[model samples]
Target chain A: MPAHSFRLLSLGIGIVKLLRSSDWLIVPGVLLLAFFFVAPTVEIALSSIFDEGLTGKHFERFATKGAYVEVFRRTLVRSVWIGILCVLIGYPIAYFIVHRSLRTQVFLMLLILVPLWTSILIRTYAWMVVLGREGIVNNALIWLGLIDKPLRMMFTTGAVYVAMIQILLPIAVIACYSAMTEIDRTLPRAAKVLGASPWKAFRHVFLPLSLEGALTSFVIVFMLSMGFFITPALVGGRKDAMLANVIAHNVEQLNWGFASALALLLLVATIIVIVVVRLLANRFVGVRSVGMAP
Target chain B: MSRKMGNPGSILLTAYTVAAIVFLFFPILIVIPMSFSGERFLGFPPKTLGLRWYMNYFSDANWIELTLRSLRVGLGSSILASVLGTLTALALARSQIPFKKAITALFAAPVVVPTVIIALGVFIFAVRSRINDSELTLIAAHATIALPFVVMIVGAAARQVDPTYEKAARVLGAGPVKAFYYTTFRALMPAVISAAIFSFFVSFDELIIALFVMSENHTLPIRIWSDLRFELDPTIAAISTLLIVFTTAAMIVADRLRRRSARKPDA
Candidate 1:
């Protein structure tokens, strides 16, 4: 046979082999994931368990230490609160963008995305500048004669809330906006045709469809908040430390075992929350609508 | 009907949205003048206007070094991530892969999980492997962070590509490799480029892991953190303004490119 024919034969064989294989394409991807992601997580988990023969000291420390418990609780509370705040703050913006004319939606979308273009560090710095005692808000208030003295804002839980909500609100808005867009306008109109009031129509026909996207948005914000370190570290008071901050502290202090344990626990807790949130949202809000992209 | 008179909820919703936008964006907009301020402090409403701080950042050796280091890490990680991610996406999407959902979830987990936890895991593994916080280690870690995003974007792009062309080419006696390169690869280029641009931004904007992992070999964010920790400086404001311009331009261009390519009938 000619070389060309031989090449053709080999190509056909390769194709046959490829078709016969279960997941040849995923081999590279799976290997990469195993190496880069799954392996590291496994290592962290294994290290936490086996400092030397599978001791439970790391987990015990977390359970026994008041500091760890406080940090964990504070982290959960702060993250949940921030997630809620973002949802509360983001829902209206999402509603506006969804209901607006097409041209207006484009412009507002840019406004929403422009902040995301800037680095999170720069944005956080801007917050520091704005909320600092000698910063813009104080100066503006003083100039306007609102108070005799500057209000203490920086390094407070308020600062953390403000900065975090700012940082994560865009995500919530985008998520909710996309969700809201999926809702059929006719559903509300149908309710109106049935003698329901406009607001009642929206409340019954529209809100339920959007709830999944809103809940998913809330979960995303909460997940991201669980990992937040810089914003809280920079803005929050010393007592406002989150799990990420504590993990960073351990990593910095060379306590690898302890840090790994804390990280694993955080991961497990995040997974549980995500699952629980999904279940709850599905039960109440009807999660099938989430698949409908706005 | 008196419904319009009675229902003030729409008005309230509009007000809340405006307040939310202001709260989210007011600080970002306020920094423009702060960067231009000729004051010794970072106080709002500059006492005077001058380009001294911009000049200071441009001339400062430390800032220059940090910028270069970030560029090296960002660009390196971006290339590594885009290449590997595109390839993996192709393999996963186009290949006859069983457990496709599971594979996709594995790729996506890194993005969903807290970066702080990933950073800790990477930190421990690096320590064990004796890979200190050198530039190379940082790049590898960043590539890991960026990989998932690249996979997602590129995979979506790949789904839009017509597999019939590759099949046709193969029928025309083209080898599988040759057919893929000639037919499928060209179609995937726009997505590849967009994913590369996004991967670069991901590495460039990333800070959490950089903070925990690269303590000594400081990236720009770490430098800014340390500077802020010590004292107030207007130089950071100046640097941030420059970054904002670069990022905005890049995103706009990428968006345009995406739109142009998507509008292509052949695509």
Candidate 2:
């Protein structure tokens, strides 16, 4: 009996200790995050701005050089285009899945998800093989007597677009589909019952409700597109270069200072774009949930 | 049905679906026939059926070594990430950990950031530390990349797990550790396993960081990348086909387990 009482006392002490030490649990987690994330970000920022002494030479180089400025401009434009393209292509598919029966929706979702499970590099490589000069499209075109010479499909801006949009479309679809599923089906049905045309009901009810998800998806795809490297490098020409490719090249060349500057610039660009997307989404949709990217 | 909307929407949707499927699957599908080509170089309509490239990949010592090295790094990183990630998940889920949002965000940051950036950071850090780009260092880098996913998925699962079981065990005179081991850990087994499998695949398929970190020793993707850069070989196609088959098998197994758990009654 005495031993059992002692055990009970110890258990009581343990419970008190657990409650008292709740904050300790976060220490390791915080340390890990700080070491991996905060430290590296600080390092990059420092390396970019300072070279032996404090100087903005790296930023100056980006400003003075027309090539860097052009690359930045093109990267932004290309990413936005790709994001818009994904939304356009993905919305119908997302709508189809959301409107279908549960079983049918699951099947379609699986189809979309299976390809996403594979590596993006593998997917991009597949495109390179398909879009090459002697690839399937070229061979088919020749056989159909469409062109006298093989078309230059690979290593072009168009090729980059095709690959990036294909990779990012699934994300948009999934995002919009999840959001669409949340909206009450009866709301749209009520519009139909109130003498509204199907198209008009969809535009006024469904579109407005789903806009937030669509916008969030757009922001995510845009940010991801900005950071694209392997796809563009493998399939894009020199002119199709994004900021990510430039950062990668600098890293390879052992120019860490320049690489950090490029990386920090990319980060800043992404943050600004995300902020703009959120503000626009909030004003247009009047819903905060739709502004957040998954 | 409204003819005004139905016809055009259906046509557009069907056309887009077909085009998207063709865009997504054509490259993956074309590799199969090309893998069997008798010709030395890659061609769309492979001249003849032959097992030469498949034979070449199997016999090539360099390719075999790289494949084995990749397997080692992948397996090591997967195991490491899963253990640490799952532990961190438990702390986040069960404990009253402060700054929950910040912690979770940090864990998932690797997914958001471009991998090339991470590679550069690790490369710079490694260079300064004088750490050689060996298999161990590469595995560490890969583990860091995969850790966040394991934490996120496992934590989500853990949040749904019942606390009553552990509480009951503890009330029945079991120690905290013993109660957790008997009740909570068993309940979390399926999620932990699933998270481990996903982390494994993330490590296995990673290429960019491996490329940045390793030069003398190459992973499977690195090998294929280098081969593509030097020359377009049928052997690379064969290797890709093999990877597709293996990945599909692993995915099926994971999916089956998920389904089985979904069908099982709560414990």
Candidate 3:
């Protein structure tokens, strides 16, 4: 080949190598997230300290405020309960579906996915209707001669738990069902054949196998509940307020530093819980079966 | 394996599942009737059956405007996120990126963390950047959240199939762009479509970020939020029922498309 042709061929090779590498395609997307997502997160973490020099004034305000402290405590406490409630409600449903025919499992899972796709606001509003004084629950009770007047069931702590669990229960079920379905149906059967009772077979074999999924589901539900604002704000009483509500209130008040502080606190709390779960689950069991994206 | 309807435990399990399903869907069922109620207050089993609230939602100029605005935002963010996220997914599937795990984690970060934190973060950042309330900022903010879903759906779709056709074309000395243009893109088209639809819903349904980042441009959820805060009306219920039907259809379609594509072999 001529010298100029050789040069052209080499240039062509370099271009192919670059194209074959292909990872450059990720830059535009990553850059967008870097500026918008990661940068904002960093700004939030720093905002509590970055207001007019490095000061903890924002966090200091949070720490000093009894109301703020109370909201954080309530958020943490309620989230744990929501997680437990979800699992208690979810496990049996998942176990039932897991034991069903493949077609039934698919159909049942689709039923669960319907409410999952529905809007959170609509779900919250539904609870308001059902639990309201003149809502169906109250109306039914009145008609049954159980009560002379409508009961005030809306705007209570129980209302919050009910709605939140309803909103989040599908997630727990799907997670656990996915894991439960992966277990060999014969393991528990084999245990039963070996003289263990049916209950013991499940406890010794099925429960141990499925618990990791339940734990993962719990973590997810718990994390999401901690950040919940809409359901709590819409259906909850003043006492039912979570940290997310407090953060939103602060944001609305144009108190950016304080809002950022509250957001950071919630984020830290979420991270801590997740890390603890990961450590415990990784050490103890088959949490790798968790269906959540890593 | 021994589960039977006659067994006490099995019967209890059956009842619990039924109750759980009711609990899951009860709110949705309650609102459907309320939306048709001629009554002004929020009560189910309407005293009179009519589409008064539905008519109100459709006829009201403000509601229509917010609906159009939300569609625009949803489409805009969907396109941006789908393109960006699809590219990232393809990149991850085909080649090595530096700190790929960390990069993927960052992409997924928005979904895991609370939306309030993200809203607060973006709000504070926007204030500093002076793009706090712009439509562009809102689109960018939503796309960031929706990006992860696109990546997730498309990444899963991309990983399921062999990319040998593209690789083979490359080895046969087809230009890199031309080979991919001809091969992988065609194969991944169904998943790409699914991802776009999913991304649209993610942005369309988002409210918290919009509440913090948007001021003049009110989305549908924002409108609903304002109304719910000020008054308990049947119109909100009407909107909810309509959205529930629409979203359920979208999800079913998306799921079917996903299953079809997963079953298809290199088509």
Candidate with maximal DockQ = 3
The digit string of per-residue lDDT tens for model 2 on B1-267 reads: 112336777677667766775665667778878888898877788878899999999999999998898889989988877777877887787776557787778888877776767777776666666664788878777878888877876676677678898899999999988998998787777767777777778888887778877867779888777666656777888887888778767766665554443343465
Better of 2 and 3 by TM-score: 3
DockQ of each: 0.49, 0.41, 0.68
Provide all candidates' interface root-mean-square deviations.
3.6, 3.2, 1.5
| Candidate 2 structure lDDT | 0.79
Error of 2 at B172 (Å): 2.6
Error of 3 at B73 (Å): 0.6
Tens-digit per-residue lDDT, B1-267, candidate 1: 112423487678777777777777798888888999988987878899999899999999999999999999999989988888887888887775556778778778888989888887777677667786778878877888888878877777777788899989999999988998997888778777877888888888888778877768888878988898767789988988898889888877665555444444463
**What C-alpha lDDT values do all the predictions have?**
0.82, 0.79, 0.86
**TM-score (0 to 1) for chain A, all models?**
0.89, 0.89, 0.89
TM-score of B chain for each model?
0.88, 0.89, 0.92
Highest TM-score model number: 3
Order of candidate numbers by TM-score, starting with the best: 3, 1, 2
Task: Give candidate 3's whole-model lDDT.
Answer: 0.86
lDDT of 3 by residue, A59-134 (tens): 8898898999999988988998899889888988999988877788888899898999988887887888889888
